[model samples]
Target chain A: MNPQPSLNALQSILETLLPQMEQGKFSKVECHFVRALLEQFKNHSRVFAELELSTRHLKEALGETENAANTLLTLAEDLQRDERTEDIGLQISEACAFQDIVGQRLKLVQKTLYSYVDFLALMGTTTQTSPATIMSGPGFTGEVISQDDADRLMG
Target chain B: MAVSKDMPILIVDDFKTMLRITRQMLAQLGFMNVTEATDGVDAIEKMGQKDFALIISDWNMEPMSGYDLLKHVRGASKTPTVPFVMVTAERKPENVIAAKKAGVSNYIIKPFNAGTLKSKLMAVLGPF
Candidate 1:
């Protein structure tokens, strides 16, 4: 699957969220958590960069193979066809290497998210305000729905 | 002196991914002699090692910001005349004015493509 759109979405979310967190009237500890979350996004960004570089290398190889294909068409030898197939296989192997890196990154993101949620829960219990309310602050306008509302919307 | 593609260029960002992406973009522009630094302090250390032809730095970083780096670069006798470009996601007027005052040669916003990078390099280096 193409990671471009997902990466763009993640980037957009980060761009919109960071400045607000920086400017928000959150407590010192809350701001510390926010900074840690930003660090987590750095890991996410690395995964996306690795994916982009892998795809770019794969595309470059395919472009070269296309140029070679023009010459191989006239030659039409079994050996040339095998070599071309091998080149594509090598690209696939290179792409698979990226899959391992992405998997590791995803696990890291998941762990960070869990820790953030736990921190939010702790804050909610201590502050007597929901995590969403604390996050949105006073003038936030984004559409935020509770789990019940989300289920109703899904129905 | 005319800009040469092989001239050493320094790119500094706290984000490793941004450093990688900027290096790739520079490579696409046929600039292969690029150095990466994680932040302003690291950049200053690298500057001590080699005289970079150009420095492209992200504005936001912990401990030492790109703005501070710009000030340091301009104040230092060794690299005072080198072209300095600031890359930032923020477009605040005051920040731009401050960077200009600090001797930034050019500035580029974040999420820029290779074409934008090339254009910024051209503006600073006078058509490389």
Candidate 2:
């Protein structure tokens, strides 16, 4: 048989295999597969940073949209008194459209922020367990539960 | 000499936002010297290398928890007298008992306002 591949060649093979491991199709893979996935995760700080920045911007945009909707509602109410004017119906329609757009954008922003928040919350609270399960016995107590678990418990 | 403005304060918590908020709140409260650790192990390593007047730690952390850090501190001769207070969401009786057993100076429950934090710190540190 041919000599075993060098450490670098083995690492390259594992690196090539990581995507399959991440897809959960290669469940029987070794610890190195998990390590490669974790290493990939560690290098994705920019993704999290962008998500944070996008969440901030989305929040600000939602706030501005809410303010605009409020202002439009006020304008529509004020214009309602002049029922005969052609512009009044147009203003009301525009206001309704603005409110709808604002509502949709707010929902989108909420979903985006919720996804990012949930991801960070997971990272914040997850506890790594060793393969031996030596530290997994019942004596352990009072650790903070993950955000998802906390939400489920509280809800 | 009294604890100067430049003396670092170790703020230990697993949550990054909580750490940032605590650091900001401490800065607002006139404690300018603040350092942060994401967990008890990081806090202990920092404490081992330097002297901090106070340790504000969250009771819940993976691997080396805050209670473990408190025990470690108590066991170490250099930092036995360091004022340690648990700032955690854990309000359970057993946790409190364990913290007290480990010689925690005070316990502050989470969602605590700045005023409550100041009051607890005053209670532990004798009005400052």
Query: Which CAPRI quality tier does the interface of model 1 achieve?
Result: incorrect
> Tens digits of per-residue lDDT for model 1 on A16-74?
76677678766778776656655555545544554454444445445445544554443
Residue ranges of candidate 1 with Cα displaced over 4 Å: A1-155
CA shift of A115, model 2, Å: 22
Let me know the DockQ for model 2: 0.02
Instruction: Identify the leading candidate in terms of DockQ.
Output: 1
- Let me know the TM-score candidate 1 reaches against the reference structure: 0.48
Go through the candidates in order and give each one's DockQ: 0.03, 0.02
lDDT (10s digit) by residue, model 2, range A4-115: 8764455566677678767776666475546754554543443465456556545655665676578667766767675446445433333343333333334444545565
The per-residue C-alpha lDDT of model 2 at residue B103 equals 86
The lDDT leader among the candidates is 1
**Any idea what lDDT model 2 has?**
0.62
